[model samples]
Target chain A: MNVPRHWREQIRRYRLVGSKCTDCGRLSFPNRAVCPKCNSRNNENYQYAGRGKIISFTNINSPPKEHKYNLPYAVALIELMEGPVITAQITDARAEELEIGMEVEMVTRKIMEYNDDGIICYGYKFRPIVEYAHP
Target chain B: MKPNKSVGIIGYGAYVPKYRIQNTEIARVWGNDPNLVPIREKSVPGADEDSVTIAIEIARNAIIRAGINPSDLRAVWVGSESKPYAVKPTSTIVAEAIAATPFVNAADWEFACKAGSETIQACIAFVGSGMAKYALGIGVDTAQGAPSDALEYTAAAGGAGYIIGSAKESLAIIEASISYVTDTPDFWRRQHEHYPKHGNRFTGEPSYFKHVLSSSKALMEELGTKPEDYNYAIFHQPNRKFPLEVAKILGFPKEKILDGLVSPYIGNTYAGSALLGLAAVLDKAKEGDKIFCTSYGSGAGSDSFSLEVTDKLAERKGKAPSVKSYIERREEIDYAKYARYRKKIRA
Candidate 1:
C-alpha cells in the first residue's frame, strides 16, 4: 500500500499489462520475467485485450480486515481473449447475477485506501459486457 | 477556432456508472416531490471508482475504437471538476492506466461544465497543427453536490472521451468551431468548498444562454450553415430544460435535440455533459449527417463545433459499446446505498 509497493505493481494493476512467452506464446499475468510454458527465458511485454469470460466465481461475504468494508463482493477467474486465466474482482453486478461463461471486460477502478491520509490505490476490475444491437 | 489543418474525431467512447440513484429516492430523503426533480436518475460511482478510473475506462474504449496501439496516443488531456486529487494530475494516471505513459504529454483541465469541450479544442489544435498525430481528450466527473442541496438532484457522474486525428482517418470530421467567453460569475466552487454555489436564475440568461447562443450562432455564421442544415443539434444539458430552451431559441427543432438529451437519465456530468450528448448523437448518426454541438461552462464560456459524419463512422461505430448501451446498463440504488457508494457516509 506504500508508494514504492504501489509503483512496483503498476504494470499488472494498470491495463493487465503482463508478459508473454515468445517461444510458446503463453501469457502470464503479474508479468513473470521467465515463461513457465516453454521453460524459456525468451519473454516479451504484452498487454491483454481486456476482453474475457468468467470461468469461475465466489462471493466474499466475509472479507479480511483490510477489505471488510467491501464485504459481499464477488471475485472471479476470467479467461482472457488472448488465453490467460487470471483472478480479479467482479464489479457492477451482484453475487446472484454472476454466471459461469459470462462475458466481461476490464475496467480501471480504486482498489483500496491504503491509509487514513487517503493514499488510495487503483487497479483493474471486471464487469459484464453489455452487448448492443447494431443500428 | 478552426484548426490550420483539418482534424476530427477518429474515435470516441463514453462511461456511465452502473449504479443509479432515482429521483424519487432523493426526493424521499429531502421531503420533496420526485416530479419536481430535474433528472429522473443520477449515476453514482462505486467505492472502487472515481474520476481517474472513469477516465481510464473510457480512454481504453476510445483507443479500441481508434484501432490504434495505446502507445500511438501522443497526448492525454482530462477535464473534470471531481478529479481524484486536487493537487495531482488525473491525466497521468489515465495515461498510465491505458499504457500510454512515458511518451505522451498529459495534463488536467478545469472550466466547470465546459472543461471537457475545452479539451476537445486543445486536442484538435494539437493534432491539426501536427504537434501530435493522435491526442485523447476526455470529459469526466464524479460530480459532488452538498447533502440535501438543490444541486444534488442534478449534479451526477459520467463522461465521454474522443481521440482526435486527421480528417482522412476520422469517423466524424470537424468542419468548424468557435468559442464565446465572458467574465460571467454565475457558478463557482471556492477552494476547500465541498459543493459548488450558483447565482440561481443568474446561471441562465446571462450565462448559459448568452454564451451558448452566441457561440452557436457564430459557428453557424462562420460555416454558412443554419439550424435547419444540421441533422442533429446538441447543447450542454445542465437540466433537460436548459438545452431544450437553448435549442428552441436557436431555431433547432425538438427532434434535433432529443437524440442527445441524456441528462435526464444520468444527471449533469458537468464537464462530461456536452461530450456525452455528442456521443449519444454519434451513436445513432449515419454518414453525411451534419451535427452541431455546443457546450457551456460556468466562469463562463461556450465552445461550439460543426461536425460532418464520415463513412468510416459506420465501420468504427461497433469498435466499442454504444453510448445507448452504457445508458441502458443500470441498477437502481436507494439513497443510503448511494450515500455509501459516493462516500458521503463513512463506514
Candidate 2:
C-alpha cells in the first residue's frame, strides 16, 4: 500500500530506477506487483536511469497538504533517457528557470516532512544535476 | 489473442439528471440577472448521485439499449475527472453494479472530457488486440465549482455509455480515429477537491479550439473529407457558444454544430459531453450518414473520430431514453433546490 523508503529515495535522487521483469522485458515505473506486460509475479530485477530530460513541468503555486511547505514548487514529468516517462518534483533550479526538454540528473534529497505527534518524518526528492561531483 | 479487430458501438445510452437550473436562477442567487451569466440552463445531480452512480445508470441503459445481458460484457472502463473516490477504482463499483465482472480489464481513467472517448478508443484497441469482446466506456460527473463562479453555470451533470465491438451486431461502425495532445494546464482539479482550477481564456481558444480544430482538420484531411461532409461535429462542450464558434471557424456550417451543444442544456459532464451529443445526433441521424466527432479534455487533448450509422440504429431508436425526453422529464428547481442538489449550502 506504500512505496518503500529507499525506493522513494531512488526516485527523489532522480536515479531513474524501475523494475524490469526478468521473465518479460516489460518496464515498470515505481516498480509493480506483477509485470503487466507479461503478467509475471517475479519482479526481482531493478534498473536505474541515472539521466533523463524534462518532458513537461508545472509550477504549482498552491499544492496539497503533503506538499504544502513546498509552495511554488515544480513538478515535472521527465522522459528518461533510457525509457518511460515518470512524474517527480524538480530540483536545483528556481521555478522560473525550468523548461520542457531540459536535461537533468537525479540527486537524492529530502522530499517531505510529516508531523506525527511532534516527530519529524522525512522523505526523498529528486534534485536537478547542475554540477556532479565525482566520488 | 490480439484484439486488433474493429470494435464498433453496438449500443449507446445517456442519462442527465432531472433538475434544471436556469442561468437567471444562478444570476439571481449571485444578485445579478440572467444575461450576466450569458449561458442558459444546466442539469444538476440529486443528493444520492455521484459520478460512479450516474455512470452506472448510463451503462445499464446502454446494456438495455444493446439488448444484451450486463453479465456478458468482458471489460469495463469509467472515464471521468470527478471520480467518487481517488484511491479505489470507480470502475470496479460500476462494473459490479452493472454485473460486468469475471472480466479481465476494468479501471477508472482520467483525461477530463476526452476521457470517455479515449476510453472508447482504448477499448477498440483492446478488442482489436483480441483481449476483450465487449467493453463499456462510461463518463459521468457532477462537476462542482464555487457558487457565483463562472464555472458554476456550465459545470453540469449527465453521462453517456457505449458498448463497443462487431459491425454485423453493432449499432454504428467506428470508421476512423485520430488524437492530438498538448501539454497545457487549461483546467484541472486535485484529490479530495470539490472545485476545479482553470486558466480561464486559456481553456478556450488556446487549448480546446486549438487542439480540437487541429485534430479535426487532420482527421478530415486524412480521410479526404471536409467539414461539410459530416452531418455533425461534436466537441467537448464547455458551453453552448464554443461549439458553434469553433465549428464556424473551421468552416463547419452552423446547423451542423448546434445539436452538439448539449452542455448548455445539460451542463458539462466532464467526460460525457461529446458522446451524449452523439446520442442526441443518433436520435435524428439517417442510415449511411457520417458523424465527425472531436472530443477535448483539459490538461488538454482531443480525439476525433468518424462514425457511420448502421441499419441496426432503428431497432434501438425509441427503446432507449431519448435526449429530448430526458430534457422534458426534468423538474425546474429554485436556487435553494439548486444549492441542495449541488451540496453547496449545508442543511
Candidate 3:
C-alpha cells in the first residue's frame, strides 16, 4: 500500500504482465523468476491482451475491512486467451448473472483507496464482454 | 485562425461505462416523474472507474484505430473537469497506461465541457509545428451531479479520444477550428465544492447558445463554407434538446446532427459531450465527407471545428469498437446501486 511497493508492481498490475517460459513456451499468470514448466530461469515478460473467459467465480458478501464499501462483489478465475489464468474482481455485472465460461476483458480500475488523502491503488479488473464485438 | 500546417484526426475513439441508470429511476427517488427530463437515461461509472480509467480505455482504443505505436505519440493531452486527483495530472497517468511515457508532452486541461476540445486545439498546434508525427487529445469525465439536483439527471461518465497527425495520414482532416469565449459566470463550482452550480435560465441564451453560435458562424465564415456544404454537423449536448436546438439555429437540418447526438442515450458527459458526438459521426463517415462540429463549456465558451473525412477512415475505423457499440453494451442499474457506485452513501 506504500509508494515503493505499489509503484514497483504497477506495470504487472496495470497490464497483466506475466512470465512466459522461453524453454517450453508456457505462460505463467503471475510473472516468476523461474519457469514453472521447464524449471528454467529463462523467462520473458508477456503482457496479456486482457481478454479471456471466466473459468470459475465466487460471490463475496462478507468482505475485508477495506472492501466493505462493495457490499456484494464477484471474483473470478479468468483464463486469458494467450494461455494464463488469473484471479480478478469482476465489474459491471451482478453475482447472480455470472456463469462459468462467460467472456471478459480487462480494464484499469482503483483497487483500493485507504482514505481521501492516502495513495489510491489502481489495477486491472475484468468485465463481461456480453454482446460485444471486436474487429 | 487557420493553421498553416495540415493537421487532422488520424485515429479517434470513444468510451462509455457499461452501466446506465434511467432518468425515471432518479426521478423515482426524488418524488417526481422521470419522463420529463430531456435524456432517457444516463451512463454511470462503476465503483472502481473514474476519469483516469475512462481516459485510459479511450486512449487504448485510439491507439488501436490509429494503427500507430504508442512510442510514436509525441504528446498525450487529456481535458477534463472531473479529474481523480486535485493535484496529480490525468494526462501523465493516461500516457503511462498507453505506454507513451518518457518522451511526450503531457498535461491536463480544464474548461468545463469544452475542455476536451481545448486539447484538440492544442494538439493542432503541436502537430502543426511539426514537432512530432502524432499527438493525442482526449476529453473525458466522471461528471459530478449533486443528489436531487437537475444536473444529476444529465451529468454522466464517458470520454472520447482523438489522434492528430499529418493530413496525409489522417482519417479526418482538420480544415479549420476557432474558439469564442467570454467572461460569463453562468455555471461554476468553487474549491472543495462537491457539485456545480448553474445560473439556471442564464445557462442558455447568454452562455451555451451564444458562444456556440458565435464560434460556429465565425469558423464557417473564415472557411468560406455554408451549412449546405457540410454532410454532417455535431453540437454540444447538455441534454436531449440543446444540441438539436442549436443545430437548427445554425441552419443544419435535424438529420445531419442526429447520428452524432449521443446525449439522449448516455446523458451529458461534460468534457466528453461534443467530442463524443464528433467521434460518433466519424465512425461512419465516408471519404470526402465534410463535418462541422461545435462544443460549448460553462464559464463559458465554444470551440468550433470543420473537418473532412479521408480515404483512410473507412479502413482504419473498424479496428476499434464504435461509439454505437459502447452505447449499446449497457446494463441497467437501480438507483440503490447507482448511489453506491457514485458513492452518494458514504459509510
Candidate 4:
C-alpha cells in the first residue's frame, strides 16, 4: 500500500518543535512536560530554529509494512542547536549527500497514511541546509 | 549494621544488527497491504548473528562501557527465549568471548520478554548475597514468527546487557524491586517451535497489563513513590502502542513514556526493548531523577523496579554505544530478505 501523495508531501515539508531545559540547559525535541535534569515543570520557551547538524545516519532500503511510502531513504540523528539529538528523515539529499556533523534544517513532509481511506500522516523531516554564494 | 547492599550496574552494552527490514514490503509479500500492521522498520540479524553472538557483542560493549576488568566478573547469565542451542550454555560462550574466565555461577534464563530483567534480579540477588563480587546479566534475541502472523511486524532483533555489583562499587544503583507472578497463558512457545502462541486480547488485560500494573503498583506502594515522581517510565513493549496504553492506564503521562515508545518504530526486540528504552532515557536523565521500569513475560509475570539516576550514570553517558548511534547503524533488508531470514522460504 502506498501512502497518499499529499501526506507524503506534507511530511516531506514538516516542522519539528522542541523545548530547551532552563535548569540543565539541554534541548528536548517534541517537548518534555518535565525536566529530566532538575525535575522542573517550568519549560524555557524555545522552538528549534529547525536547524541542526547531522551526527550520524543510515539509508533504510526496507521499511515496515505500514511505511510502504518510505524506501531507500536516509534516516539520521540531527543535533538541534538546543543540544538534544533528534531522529528524522533526511530529504532533498541522497545517501551520499550526508555526512556526520553536516548542517541541516527541519522541513514539513508527508510520511505515510491510509492509502485507500486517504488519511494522510505528516511529519517533520530534515534537509541539508546548503550555503550559497551571492552572485 | 550496614544498610541492605544496593545492587549497581557495573557493565552495560547493546546490539542491533546492520540490516533493517521494512514492514511495508513484508506486508506486500504476504498478500496484504502495509496498513495491516502499523510497523515501520525492524532490525535484521546478520547471517552470523544469533542469540549467542548478539549477547557476546552486548557483553563486550558492557565490559568496555563499565571499564571493569573481565576477570572481575564472577558470574555470567544469558537471558533469552531464543537461545541458539538447546542444551549448550550460551553464557559460557559469551564468557569466553569476553574473556571472563571460569564462571563461578553461570546460566541461561528464559521467561519470555521478562527474561532480561529476571536475570538482572537474579544477579542482584547473587551479588547482594556476597556469592559473587560481579555478575553479568545479558538479554539478546532475534525473535521470529510467520509473516502477517501479527507477530511478524514487530519481531525484530536486538539485545542489552548489565553488570551488577555493590552500589559503592558500581554504575547505576538498583533502589527497589517488586515482582508478581500468575499462571495466565497469554503467550507460549512450545517445546520445539520457533514462534509463540498468543491470545492477543487475553495478553492485554489478563496478562501483560495485569501483571505489569500489579507489580509496578506494589513496587511504588512499597517505596512510597507515585507515578508523577518518575522522570521516565520503561515498560516491556511487545510493540510501540501497548506501552503507551499501559502507561496511560497506570496514570503516567505521555512524556513519561515517549522514550520507550521508540520500539514501535524499531519493532519488538523482545528482551532488549525495555532495557534499550531505559538506556535511551538514561542518556538524557539527570542525577537524582527517578526512572520506573516494568518487565512482562508471556507465561504471565512482571518485575517492577524503582531506579534513581546516580552521579555515576551522568559521568558514564558517552562511555558506551548511544541509543541513536545503535539505531542508525542498521542495514535495511527488504521483504525477500526478511522472508528468507524468518525461514518462510526454504533455500
| Top-TM-score structure, candidate number | 1
* Fraction of native A-B contacts kept, per candidate: 0.58, 0.00, 0.40, 0.00
Top candidate when judged by DockQ against the true structure: 1
Alpha carbon lDDT of each predicted model = 0.89, 0.73, 0.90, 0.74
Instruction: For model 3, name the residue pairs that clash.
Output: none
Candidate 1 steric clashes: 0
Model 2 per-residue lDDT tens digits across residues A10-129:
332323346778787777777787898889987763555456888888888877775554445788888777686778776535468887778885533234434422212222234454
Order of the predicted models by lDDT, top scorer first: 3, 1, 4, 2
The runs of at least 3 residues in candidate 4 whose Cα sits more than 4 Å from the true structure, single-residue gaps closed, are A1-135, B1-3
Q: Which has the better TM-score: candidate 1, or candidate 4?
A: 1
Which DockQ values do the candidates obtain, in the order shown?
Answer: 0.64, 0.01, 0.47, 0.01
Off by over 4 Å in 2: A1-135, B1-4
Q: Where does model 1 exceed 4 Å of error? A: none
- Candidate 3 off by > 4 Å: A21-24, A130-135, B33-35
In the order shown, what is each candidate's alpha-carbon RMSD? Answer: 1.6, 18.9, 1.8, 17.1
Candidate 1: DockQ?
0.64
i-RMS, every candidate? 1.6, 27.8, 3.0, 18.7
